[model samples]
Target: MSNRLLAIVEVSPEARIACQANGCGHAVYKRIHVVSINGSLQVLGSECFKRLFGGAIGGNPAYSSSDGRRLTDAERRMLQENTAQLVAQLEAEHEAAQDPAREKLQRISQSGIAREASGGPPHRFRAPLPVRQPAAPRRHLGPTPEAIRKYEAQAKIDVRAKFDVDPNLPGWRGLVLQRITELSKSDEVPD
Candidate 1:
C-alpha cells in the first residue's frame, strides 16, 4: 500500500489535489492522475506524477468516477467536446498556442486512448503534458547563391540516396545530373 493507489476522490471540482509522491508535495489541478500499486493509493500532483511516471492519461476502465460507475458514452463525448471548447477558451484567453486540452488531444490521437478492460470504463480524466517552452527561432541566413547551391546539391544527393543510384548503370550520372539541372533555374543557380 505504500506506492499504490487504493482509492482517490475529487474533494472539489475547482480545488487542487496535494501530491503524495516522495519528498515533494505540491497542489495540482487540470490533470489529476491516480494509480494503485501494491494495494496502496497515492495522489500524485500533475508535475510530480509526470516526473516520476512518464505516461500520460489513459482510457483505463479500472478507474471510476466518484459515483463508482465508468464513463458513459455521453460523458466521453462531453469530455471531447470540452476539449474543443477549451480550444475556443484558449483563443479567447489568448493562450491558444499553449492550450493543454489541445495538447492532450494531440497526444491521444498519436498514442491512442486505451481502456482498463474489455468491459471496463470508457474514459477517464487525463493529465496534460507539462507546458513546454518554445524553442528559440533559428537565425535565417540570407539566400546567398552559395547557400542555394548547397541546398540544390543536397537535394540531388537526397534524390540519389532515395533511388540507390548504381554508378555501374549506364547513364546513371547523366540521369542524376539531368534531374538536378531540370529542378534548378538560372535565378536559383545564380552567376
Candidate 2:
C-alpha cells in the first residue's frame, strides 16, 4: 500500500485532527493529507510527516530546527522575525558604505571646476576632479664639466713638477700629461 503526499491543509484551531503516522497520535492544527496507491486518504501532523517523508513534501526539504527536529509554530514565527531584522541591518550597513562616495560626487557637481569640454553648462554627472601634487625638485649627481677641466689643468702642473724633480722618471709621465690635455679639450663627460 504505497502512499504519496497530496496536500498540507490548515484547519481551524478548534477543529484539530489526530496524526496517523505509526505510533504518533498527537493532535495538530496543520495536517498533511496523503493518498495511497489504492485511493485511501490519510491525515498526519508535521512531525509525523517528517518521519514518513524524510522532511520533504514534494521533493522540497522542509525547514527544521538546528537539531534536525521540525520547528513548532512559535519557533517558525521567531525565525521569520530574526530574518527580517538581519535584512534591515544589512541594508543600513550598505547605505552607510555608499555615503562617502556619494558626498564626494555631490561636492564635485556643486563646484564650478567640473564644466563640460564644449563650454556648455556644468554637468551634474561628471566624474570627481583628480587631486594633483606639486612636482619634487630634481637633484644633480657627479661633477660638472668645468670642475673636470680645472682638476685636469692642476694635475698637469703637478706632473710637470714631478718630472722636473727627477729627470730619470719613466716616459709614461709625458703620455699621462698629453692624455689629460686631450680630455680637457673634448666635450665627452667621464663615467
Candidate 2: clashing pairs of residues? none
Best-fitting candidate, scored by lDDT? 2
Q: Candidates' TM-scores?
A: 0.26, 0.28
Candidate 2 has an lDDT of: 0.52
Cα lDDT tens digits, model 1, 96-124, are 44578888988775443444445556666
> Residue 89: error of model 1 in Å?
32
The residue-level lDDT of candidate 1 at 155 comes to 50
